[model samples]
Target chain A: MAFASSRSRPDPAAAPDGPAYLPSSVRNMVKLVVAGGLGVGKTTLIRSVSETRSLHTEEVMTAPSSRVDSLAFTPRKTHTTVTMDFGRLTLGESGETVLYLFGTPGQARFRQAWLDTAYGARGALVLMDLRRPEVSYEAMDLVEESGMPYAVAVNDFPGSPVLDAATVRADLDLHPETPLLFCNALERESSIDALIGLVSHSLDVYRRNTGP
Target chain B: MSRRRDPVRITPAYLATGGRTSARRALPDVLTRLVRVDGRAAASLSPPQHHLLTAVDGGDLTLADAAGHLRLPVSAVRILAGDLLDLGLIQAVEPAELPDVELLENVLDGLRKLKKPA
Candidate 1:
């Protein structure tokens, strides 16, 4: 429920300067998804890494989508909305490649909307909550269904007990090839490391799929 | 005798932007960057549309970036951008395909430089 922009600031890379708006020698804007359950800090991670203040774009669900998308859970009398938090981080010294991080809502009802956000994304970073390991299933399932390789980051929430990593991994049913790491989403360094892990893992996945 | 309604007003409350609420929809793709093609054509656009052109005219920003820069909703901005596109006021630059190895290496290198010590 927290707005991710609280900690966000204007990234030096995204200043009013020429490099901020224009594409340089190599113009690459890659979409990346920060996937996780309700309180696992998807938005926090994006806010930590974004150069500019993160923008959470709310797309209000109209009557048609509610009628079709809101099954299982009864639709509210009012509009049902989906929020996709967007953040931009410039990668490489030249800043040729910009990562557009989309932090998606993790819920059973928003599956379709989540996929809509994930579309065209090169990969996803799945945030896992050790306290409620079951919620990780929803995130992993969505990413798997989309067929984009993903990495898992266990958010170090204040009260979460430090348990055996293997047991947590077993509960989540993670793939052997998947990369797993620990992170405190609120911390810039921790979040960046998690992201680095994801981008690195995704690169390997892509190489495997496409061959040498 | 029947009375005539105000032509500029569409709904009773939403008459702010001269009734051009923008039926405008459609954008090429999220990654498509746009640049102004005709400066003169921009003159005919509404204030919002002109605002969009000015931002896009600054550089080759994607539809999403343009919307972000203009602080307008993506859907609404897409619609207005689409209208300008149909008139050839702007050109959409489709992104080139990037190899995975090169892309990943670039990102990893960038992250290494940016991330502070644990």
Candidate 2:
């Protein structure tokens, strides 16, 4: 089903409440982390592949409230709210499985929050902008610390530098086994390819860990 | 109703969880997918517990989604869910192990099928 210049029109499938609930057949719910710096297209990639409209949820930091309490003895308290965008993708013929993509920041400031988001995740899809490759270092390190498999997807932006995969790998100081690929985050197929790379790599890791 | 009129209306955390700060088992995170298992429990639930169950009634929604839907802090939601779990009113779908090899393969196959043609 192709449309002429479909980008110009809103997608009915992307309606915020299109399907109020997951199909009853769903049994397994898997999660993957979409981590990157601000403006690295985490949400864009999620929107591209997500079956439903992306949803945003907030994680409130409770520590700051006490600090603000001592400052002025005021009733008002301050809390740092970090918003995470996520979307759902139902799989299997009966839609018995569902995958969730959670868009999260890879910064150190949200280390505590990562405990909640990264928990029980299968892997991480760390998006990088080759023009500013330095921004992805924290994300890579964070994923490594979590001990889960992660793949780096270089999201190509206009006028971004085009370096060979090996050079980019060395620049990012990535492990040899870590999968690195490129994709245009705005394109659904391209983004799915990136996710495919990550999940395949995760399968390889799982095999290596569990033995034949 | 206005922030100016009532600057800070703090609902003590204990009020939400009956002074139970921690659950018997590890708490489910925001991403944990939860579903209502015992519909009959609705009749005996407190208001907060009822809202949590209602939030997950028809579908398997993530804890974060329930928090957002209920307009409650994620921490409160965790505690509320913990109580629900103790009562066997709800269940989380997360597996004890990392998504197994078969599941990963299924995800890969699904992604391949959903890919748009170039």
The number of the candidate with the highest lDDT is 2
Per-residue C-alpha lDDT of model 2 across residues B3-58, encoded as one tens digit per residue: 43322212444465665544565665566667778644555777778767776776
Q: Which candidate has the top score in DockQ?
A: 2
> How do the residues A1-212 of candidate 1 rate in per-residue lDDT, one tens digit apiece?
12333334454454542223655554777788998777788888888778766665454444443335544465554446566777788776676888788888657677866765676777898998888867767777888888997888999988897977787677777778888899989887788888888888888888888896
Q: Note the B-chain TM-score for every model.
A: 0.61, 0.64
Predictions in order: lDDT: 0.69, 0.74
The weakest ten consecutive residues by lDDT in model 1 chain A span A1-10
Docking verdict class for candidate 1: acceptable
Measured by TM-score, the strongest candidate is: 2
Per-residue accuracy of model 2 over A79-158 as CA lDDT, tens digit each: 56567888778776777778889888877666656657788788999999988877877777888899999999999999
Candidate 1, residue B78: CA error in Å? 3.2
DockQ in order? 0.30, 0.38
Residues B1-118, model 1: lDDT tens digits: 9876433222221121233434354443555677778554555777666766777776677766665555444445666777778777887776445776777777778888875332
- In candidate 2, stretches whose alpha carbon ends up further than 4 angstroms from where it belongs are A1-20, A64-78, B1-25, B29-31, B39-47, B71-73, B95-99, B116-118
